[model samples]
Target chain A: MSDVTALHPGDTGLSVATGRTEALTGIAAGLAWLLAAVAAAAFDDLGDWLETQNYAIGVGVFGLSFIVLGLTGRWFPRGAAWVTRAGPWLIALGLVLTLWQLAAAKLGWLPQPFFPPPQGILEVYTFEYEELASHFLASFRLLAVGFVIGTIAGFLVGVSIGWSHKAGYWVHPVLRFIGPLPATSLLPIVFFAFPSSWSASIFLIALAAGFPVAVLTWSGVANVNTAYYDVARTLGVKPLGLIFKVAIPAALPNVFIGLFMALGAAFSALMVAELVGVKAGIGFYIQWSQGWASYANVYAALILLALLCSGSITLLFRIRDRLLSWQKGLVKW
Target chain B: MVAVELRPEQPAASAGASLDIENVSHAFDLDGSVLRVLDSVSLNVEPGEFVALLGPSGCGKSTLLRLIAGLEPPRAGQLRENGQPITGPHPSRVVVFQDPTLFPWRTVWNNVALGPEAQGSLKQQRERVDATIDLVGLSQFAKAYPHQLSGGMAQRVALARALVNDPEILILDEPLGKLDSLTRLTMQSEIVSLWRSKGFTSILVTHDVEEALFLATRVVIFSERPARIKADFRVDLPYPRHRGDPRLAELRRESLALLGLAASW
Candidate 1:
């Protein structure tokens, strides 16, 4: 890690010569964004469409910032290098947006209602942001609560089943039976059984997250090197110490894998639970927007959901890397 | 000023404890059938004695070490340490297995501190742990993780880990079996010096006849499966015994002959 950080600029992918090319790409990305802005503003709608809410201006500013970054890259070398790495993708996004403007709102090649232009999507974020933000918050809250409860419960269940033969005999069969079934399949029963849709949604998310965690935790505990237990025992470690210190630490790598799986499962469960009955969440928002034929709002909510999930997974990976830094060449991230 | 101390004063060797293994027979349930591993194996080790058990690959030497360490109860007989029956694992009786088995997640210092940490005496034994690390010549690598250390260094850390407990009886199950020849020779001497300084009752299981002859004051040879002691002889040598000693060479040949590997060599 230190070696990479200490590398000279000449040895890096973004050498002085490449740095110049990166600046040019940044400028090119900015120009493409400017073109997208012009395309959105210059063209007249084929039919009556909702107000774009100064979406063109927003696009213009985004383009301007890119142009500025490209021009002033030398002042912030590191930040500019990062921007340079992302330059091609930025240009591609601009080209895609410009094409969307031509196809949907301007030329009517694609129906306006079903396939709203990038500006239309931007308008949802700009104008109906309050509603979207509220739904996002609601979704975030539900997912957070459900995932936390599920992970904690799963960890306990897994540890218990792993450590004791009696617990394993009882819970292992139940887990094997239920663990494979998708939490979404249990929606009808869960909704019927729980008092409120909110509680039901939480339960569903928890169920989705919990199963993987439980199974993986159990695997980790059960598969711990018997030598570790022997060492601890000879050292006068009590039963509880054996579980917490020896078993748990050794099982952490496996536990992280389970946590990652649980995160994915929780995301799936959260969406299904929200889509089925939750009044205010991104999933419900998407459903409601689809009902109103507001595809732009749907697209915006989907983007937010993708960001939330990916960001969460990234955060989990970061935590795992830090915790398991001691591990070498055994498992790759 | 009055000061209260919670535990007994730390002893270097903790006054080596005598071990008495009396007609101990052990077996394993292999798919519902009892596969006997030991047959009434009886041996008495005096305090501070370095006794090496030499045998073939599957001669149950390790199983006997485990029995002595109280990792498992023998099927038929009792093993006593300092006149007390070893029902289960105790800090005073520790085994260093063939594998270093240091926790990958822990630094060398933390690994060495495991005994005290497990016994809930880490706060008091911290200095002893450091001293043991230094004793094994690993003071510089105390903060290094197990994965970073070479095989020999890892074994040294394992030694420090067991020694930090101030164990009276140190059981070694082919502890140096996996090391390279050069490192193995260095470690053999280190073990001898440590045994001398600590005065712990050491029982080592080794496959190498020369190793047994060099390090142990007494070498006990065992027969094949369900191991029974075939021969026991004393190596009457002083500290820092030379590898080229004619007496050691004579004993190695005898040990090899007993294990039925003499004809090949």
Candidate 2:
């Protein structure tokens, strides 16, 4: 801890003090695990209690981890940073899980079939991993296809409408009328229009994703600074060159805004589409599990959905960062 | 130091085209009202000569440059390039706007390469593109994007972009207007050096009287509102004229008085 404190100047005492606090937090986390283990072993459960082996293993592993991290964290700066940052959150998570186990499983404060112990949800992952993986893959495939088609079609049409006066005149009013109609609200019509449930789902997702791209692309193209066009024109850029070179590049920041909106809308549409008629996806898994009162499976599937949505959004943001790096400080992330 | 060399073999004789603006007038339709910007503006810029149009703000000096660039058709009369009537924007004439107007998406090299690229001569003139960028002292920043540049650096890229085309006429619409005082002064000399080297017929529109007298071989002043060529003065000083030259000081005073400002110099 003293060596770590020497790494940064002007704050030696404060740094040493913070390092001590970090070690203390780690010990507290270990203690919380011990307390949970004691409760699990001694307390009488209001409901039928399963064997406490899983809880015992978890407590032991966590307790060992905290003890190791506390003693040796300052030796490695990278490890120290992680421990300092995540130590409190880990402690809070452990406390929350312990309390949940006591209330939901031991005391039966929350009714069964609706609320399950944390171990029960973990058990679903352990037992039904294959089925969950398949469902996730299916949903991912549908999202990829629909998202690609929608974004491409939307971009082309938006660029056309924005670039050409004739196209704008013909399409702008029609877009204005239909673009505002929510894609989910069109489900009844979509069902009648499409022959298969899969096609209907894809269509719904595509429509959901396309509107924002089109509208934002239109506005982006329309609002490009006239000075850019003037400069390009004097440089001998033809009409096609003007559209492709000046208008498109200038409008890219707004196009990314459209893509972000499309991602959100696509996710919402994906979930709803899967719930309505899709045979196998995470959303369908949730609905099917809910019908049989398998709350553990439902919670497990919900967790997977959360991870998948956030993971995909993160991927999109990474791509945006790479392409639009010039706009770094101008936009507030 | 790698000596920056512009392509000397690129037909220097036809590189500068004499501009003849004969009784030209232009107006803009501002919300169903005709705002007369230029009224019978007539001037001649000889090939390889540096001419400056000096005027007050909103006096349509820039509008006249745009006309010469063929960006807009005059409301009346004709603008000619080497005896040919100007009908539309051509590759032989390029305008550098006050805003730099560097496409934010492109790097310094790509922005400067846009002119040759548009002309479909990028394949043949690739070396010229590299040379022009080097000439502007931005070879190190070839791959740097426009947003990464300072105001002065971006404007240098803009100038490089115009020069790469090897335009017969280079029209500058107060291209250094947005720079800080120090950057502006530096750029003023850079522009003069570039003009001296290239020897393209140049027309600069500026509100700064000192800038006009410093850069232009001939200075034409415009009146407010319906801008007409009020007066034209020839600067016969030798190349590399001193800033504190008594002749320049005399002309600055007279030009300021003509523009309805008391000379502070």
Best by DockQ: 1
The fraction of correct interface contacts reproduced by each prediction comes to: 0.91, 0.81
- What's the distance in Å from true for residue B172, model 2? 0.8
**Residue pairs in collision within model 2:** none
* Residue A47 lDDT (model 1): 60
Interface RMSD of each: 0.8, 1.0
Q: Per-prediction RMSD in angstroms?
A: 4.3, 3.6
How accurate locally, in lDDT, is each candidate? 0.87, 0.85
lDDT of 2 by residue, B155-174 (tens): 99999999888788999999
Report how far residue A253 has shifted in candidate 1, in Å.
1.8
Model 2, B208: alpha-carbon shift in Å?
A: 1.2
lDDT by residue (tens digit), candidate 1, B144-217: 99989999999999998998887899999999989999999999988887777667899999988888888998
Give the range of the ten consecutive residues with the poorest summed lDDT in model 2 chain B: B1-10
